[model samples]
Target: MPSTSHTAPITADLVRGALDLEPTANGILPHRLPARARARNTDGQLAMAESQPSGVRLVFRTRATAVELDTLPTKRVYIGAPPRPDGQYDLLVDGRPAGRATATGGNTLTIDMSTGAVEHTTGPAGTLRFTGLPERDKTVEIWLPHNETTELVALRTDAPVEPAPASGRRTWLHHGSSISHGSDAASPTTTWPALAAARGGVELVNLGFGGSALLDPFVARTMRDTPADLISVKLGINLVNADLMRLRAFTPAVHGFLDTVREGHPTAPLLVVSPILCPIHEDTPGPTAYDFSRLGEGRLLFTAAGDPGERAEGKLTLGVIRDELKRIVTQRAADDPNVHYLDGRDLYGEADHAELPLPDRLHPDAAAHRRIGERFAAHAFAAEDGPFAQAEE
Candidate 1:
């Protein structure tokens, strides 16, 4: 017997973690940063990262035994690098992963790093279907691909669906670099932030933009406006890699960013996390470039481009950034008890690096992501003195 299929319109009320939704030609596109914040900058990498929907998902309650979603994904392609895999959609039934699926066709975004050229090729949307679910009412969460820019076109189920009721969980808003953006992670729900959120028993709003976590004023402003019970900003790696600022500018920028966030969340638990172990950039500054020598050998790796001697002229490195961050947070914590600091090395440090090294010399691999997520959960949520412990309690 054929099962009845009910089509449901994808609307803002059904989405979570995204700040804004843009009405697209075929569907709705989620944006981590609202339109006003996005309009203030023109960096292509940042623009791409914000639209990838790292922590965004659709949450609804239904008794459907089968479900389907139509999407238009913009998959990224590096002209000279290895082929990237198609994005996967992770389905969580009642907060546990039940199934995973990938769409068949979507648009392709090709990038030529050698010439800094980009090309976009449009294609038809594809559908992802899941079947054989429990027929009783349950909360269903469809976590979108963390690394792909996806548009929610349509949703179909065997039964009616409604927005899930609030779980009364504290919202943890986090902002960081590529590692936190699910780089090299297995799937959306397996990303370190997502895993940590699950362990912490909190809702997550991840603003981790890949290669774009520089302390931008717009990003600070956006963080200031967002509502969150707990907040964390992981800085330093992008600043070091991008060679965006030096010691003098970095201190002021950190203060300004924290000040802006405190304006809206004066009493919220604000955690400032430093960069993790990246040996390549620990003492050396960047403007890191791909190792073309290894690329031909079917390996994608990175090399530091800045000279070590440049450090004397105020070029920032991980070491320098960590010290500055600790000092700034210490100075501010004197009056504001809510602001706290966490050394990122405590999450993924020298020992972890030796056991599970970063595959690309930049991003952590799947195993490392799980390790970091577990460590983060223990340090941030389980510890009685941890910054996020109160939320869990």
Candidate 2:
């Protein structure tokens, strides 16, 4: 007789780290941002970034030794750049990494960055299967790829499965840019925020949209409404790189963003972090553009396009942002005792940058991700007086 295979319908309760789950024709698509916030935006980059499911995962419990998941992934392709790698699915059993797999076939989005052209090609769904698990009932978590858009199709197991109960961990809500979205990271669980959350033993809700963390009012509102025990907002890089605002507008924007968030979580431990070391934008203004010189060599690099002299006219730079953030936090902490600030350099600065340089001139590479994760965990969670520290009984 053949073993009975049980197919489990993917439901909202089974999904973790996602703010909303939309039902699709084949399965459910997890969304980090809710529809209300998304509806107010029109930027293509933000749309793509939010749909990537950076910190989202599927969690359940079963005694099955074999499990399978079918998914449809949307993969990106730069026309003149090197091919993008397949997205990875990380499997965890009882909170430990058990296995890893990558889906083969998926829909493709071909983009010509220079020409601003895009073409979409549909493809079939692929399955990720894991076998030879311990027979005892165990909790399983499947972390989706942090850089690809995936639609959860179905789940199958050799034995019965059910939704795992919450672990009673305090929820930590974080918002930031691509680095927090897991760009260039080895895997989803390895992203600095995810790794830090593990060390802190807290539930994570990541709102790290790539190239789109420009102090948007909608994003701030989203953060304001989300329930959280601890909160962190990482800003500056995106604002500087996009040349979206000058020092004049930035101060008020930051204040408004925090003000909105405080409306919901009046006394939650809120931490504001600055941008990490990016040499090119350290003292210069941006509007950073691709190093078209390296494009022909199939290597992507970035160079600051804005004039450094613009700083005299109030153009924002990393250095300026850091000073302003420190001042802002210091001023607010006088009345809002629970609010705090962490210098991004403390997480990864000149010393660490010399050892593990950012490969793309912007985003941290895999090794850097590990270093950032460990450092963030130590500074933000493990320290005796850290904002994310556990409350005394």
Candidate 3:
């Protein structure tokens, strides 16, 4: 059986009706459905209406200060997650904040913009509704308060939109730090992941979290669990800047993370990417500092020095770590046939650095993003025998 229960139609009317329920005087509703709505739960699963052409189900993980949702006309937005009272999220349609919803520390909050009803619940799910979406493609921006950290777990449209044919395309799973997460990228679409995915003609799952891609085991587990035909892990820079772990732990941790991923994607083509040339960290271990006050003065500077007494304990420099990554991957390739390596320096080197330096001397600017994307696509995808090589017809 194809599971008819899972195939139940999800309709706008059902969504509208759900939103139509009035909140009590206390401005709260049951997070779980009423017993009656539960009766309609097909096999203990909440049935979402089948996606319509005008609606889509966009699902991915994001850790960003701002996020945008792209959808069609007549689309609505629904969210289900544990609420954080101290954390507030702004929902922007197009470029302006369309609605502001607060997290009440409840299990869920449902916003029915169609009825102008904002409902809070304690059970386990939340919804945000936007009626009268523009007929053409629309972008919903979720801007997090500065320095606030959050993840976007899922996004979907109400209607069934056709997925582009996947017949000949390869999938790419890329992991990196803030830059990869689209930090300071002019727009979401201009982010390197989006740009690279578009250029390579491949599906992409971006696990780039701003300030959180610290070779965490949980992240490695997440990557291990994801399905993909191609995988690349960008390491360094953040580790150096944050000075989170010393070399002893950092090297093994990197190996462990890669090991975990390889366990799940044994034969999948894996590319381990080292950090690009960073002069500040090129010779010294850095707990880099910035003077935000000097931003308007057009004078941003970073100071780097070897940690006193910790230098021989092996604090990692960009140069040292890059060599270690190359050695590690080269050694692993002795037994793993599909594993490969990319020196991030190859993407942007000292020469390129001199020509198009990063504004922060840390993260690249928009122009640098385009340059890196182009180089990545050429080296990683355009190569005929590379991981993203097109399949035979």
Candidate 4:
């Protein structure tokens, strides 16, 4: 364990990329969305997702060989599935992986959709320790858990620390669903978007919300207002799994979303990515349902509940969404050449699925996140004739 020999308070100024921070009784809780937007958002799911700090981190420069951060993370507990492990804190030294740790003891929110019952219980905050560094002055980053809502209580190190030096990389703003939210990823630094951003040498502003990327106007507006050099939105699976809207509503919603974004970034490279191959929702319309049979075994999987015949009635399937997204981007590109589209399958298709199956039957596993991130970097960030062709320099 790292020694808490030299302690320093972690103030709001030390956090980077968080839109807002609320002072808590013990410390501070970082928020990815502003309070005004949060006030306007009535959806509990959206509120929780936005407050989870997907791309937020504590960044600093230090000469210490050991460090510790005390935090209270609010972790979710699902009734049907086994409890998720404590959220991971990723440590990076001079832009490279150093170590990973998880804080112990925090509140728990146990939800039971089967009965519409909810329970909340509190626990003690714990420390995340990282020891044995190079002992030279270096930039260090501690990426907060993307899946847990954490309240930072304190920071301790063997030496004083300051904010990290800026990398000056182009900022990449990306939005998507749970897959983009780092679900099942080992840590915040390894999410597909995080991996892709690291490989492409871009700063990340992630808007990935677990089961909550519904092409909301506020989300689009938020992306518009945020300063980003490269932008991408991964769409489809959430729509299919949630069965949120039919094709008629979904089409206009997408247009509205893009229209809102382009209002602020008129000429920036914008990429629209369709969903990857989720065989369960490929040809079938959905309202994906839980596979209760595996629940007792401590494995949870989802199956498309909507019928294939519903597609003719304008119900959405991943295939339909992909075709529509491609068509929309292509049509708009006739006038707006900076806007482009990439098939999600290009990042992770049927062949890749056979090799790296989605453990939850929907969200990709950690290894799959790595694969998708690498592929996305290759196809979108490095390929010639792509929107980010000049970004390679």
Candidate 5:
């Protein structure tokens, strides 16, 4: 914590809508996933995604022309691969895009999949300062990088800052995979979920973790316990890509996940969303692989390596997951009407694909994110039978 004697210091409390903030020796670690649930997660993917702080932002009321944030970010580096984009920090003034930044000087974690070995080398923390804003006091938001695992070290502004008052908008809690994690999206605010939240006029608590969003019980329990007027879980892609479970295990896991979430939010508008169209994974089973041929061409692409024949063995596919999701939601909705299902294809389908191809063949590009967000806002939040209509009303 920096001294507020000169410039006022802001803490995680000023960072509105985070699921949980755990005190760390450095400062505070904003966790989209809670500690108890994290303990149950043995997968490294979830650990990295949770710490990335997608949709996490520092919200405050300030008149300062300049604001500075000190952060320690853990960035991953893959050997024999192109460098990942630098982490981006998005700034909003009075709920509009104001500026953007990339924090330098962070620890690097070297990953070598050839040997399944990892190494970390620490670096000094860096400060990001956003300045030249209007002098009048206004609501300001600093959206943390959606990809880098960031630990907030300190927050300082030229003027004293206070937590921004609640916007009175309903909170939308969403859990999904990389596409929802802002995978190929240009910036934090441009992420599909964030764009949807903005378009729907709601506060967002995004649980979209890249390479995660498997039907983890802890995630469901977290959603169960969180305060949200609207909740949604986008399923399928990660499970298919990771090949973590068979259809037998997946079906029950989805059911159990929903069952657990209902334990806390029995009546909240809980929407179950199936994965959107991924041509490669629609019929083919995955463990997807990166197309390294395009890798050197300055384009990174992924291909579904799982054979189409694997479906005979009950392997999971997006098509299969979608059917199962629709079936489960329909069956559950008969007894629990507040629960609903949205075909992910409705947001992005074959038609949308023809116009806006997924650049990476897995994640949507920035424009596609906006398109999905708009479609989602219309269908899931604004439609006559939408879950949000009942919940928000």
Candidate 6:
């Protein structure tokens, strides 16, 4: 018999890439791709590389903050999809256009529904290279069209890549509202969750959706099924903003959410975070709206809540919701030692609010994001046995 060393044949299926996402009626899934390059050998016969694109995920998670005076020029801003027919995205970085690109033809990157990976053609591939980026720590500001639908698929950075080591460090799964989702933040890496993850020296899986951080049963189920060494849920705010539930429904819903997560992560260290200070919703119930006619050249008007009844019902306020989150987490902690609670106000309070007022009176600005990240790292991940600490060997 002849000695045979056969290599597996490469097929079209092997050559194809995909990005899987939960289905939506519009057939568009909102997602922000990892800002890194990836390559793999398929069937030990061929290699492929996927690069990050210049789009951010599209979703109505947070509104833009007021343009600041100290904005840096070196950063780049990325918007999802493309500029609308109005040519309205007047994105500025230090008062200049950041980068102009359209999502057209094969140039438009898409999220592969089957695999959750962002995919785009490399044009005859042989090492697809994406260029154009400013140096590190620069500020990027995105001005999205009001009421426009968008999907951010990927991000690119100019900073040096420091790949995580093969071993060591804990893995943290952070679930939260828009702030954790990089709302109003300059870059994906600058999001408070990302910043805290970096400072704490851990790998992070961010499930921080912008406006989708409600204590939904489906979300709880997703959290229950997902695996992580550490986990955190940032609650409140959205509940208050949407006025999704009454006090009676709110408390039980939180309990049910935590109960479900506990089913899978019984012993894992879990932290529940409430909303930080927001004077707009601090005492009053709100369906917040913006009068953009004055700011955006009178061409755009933004409306969030149409129901005044919900606001008047006094059902949802950050003050009330925060208390409920604390109560539920406290009660849950009595039965489980690994569970912990952190007041969102501790990370940011009225004093900080006075100094760094949110442009929309909700989400934090970039500087506030940095402050919150640093504070979280100090209080939540300071010690080896801290709230974000890994399970002991």
By lDDT, the better pick of 2 and 6 is 2
lDDT of 6 at 7: 21
Worst 10 residues of 1 by lDDT: 1-10
For 259-341, candidate 3 gives per-residue lDDT tens digits of 99988999888988888777878877867665344535654445564564465778877887898888998899999978888
Candidate 2 residue lDDT tens string, 191-285: 99999999999989999999999999999999989989999999999998899999999999999999999999999999999999999999999
Cα RMSD to native, each candidate?
Answer: 1.1, 1.2, 13.3, 1.6, 2.4, 13.9
What are the runs in model 5 whose C-alpha is more than 4 Å off? Answer: 1-5, 390-393
lDDT-wise, the better of 1 and 2 is 1
Task: Give me the displacement of residue 130 in model 6, in angstroms.
Answer: 6.4
Give each model's whole-structure lDDT.
0.93, 0.92, 0.56, 0.88, 0.87, 0.54
The deviation in Å at residue 300 for candidate 6 is 8.9
Which candidate has the highest lDDT of all? 1
Ranking by lDDT: 1, 2, 4, 5, 3, 6
Regions of model 6 farther than 4 Å from truth: 1-166, 296-314, 390-393
Give the TM-scores of the predictions, in the order they appear. Answer: 0.98, 0.98, 0.61, 0.96, 0.95, 0.61
The 10 consecutive residues of candidate 5 with the worst lDDT sum are: 1-10
Which candidate, 2 or 5, would have the higher lDDT against the true structure? Answer: 2
> Which residue ranges in model 4 land beyond 4 Å of their true spot?
1-5, 391-393
Better structure of 1 and 4 per lDDT: 1
List model 5 lDDT by residue over 35-120, tens digit each: 88889999987888888889999898978888888898888888877788889999999999999999999899999856769999
- What TM value does model 2 have? 0.98
Candidate 3 C-alpha error for residue 175, in Å:
0.8
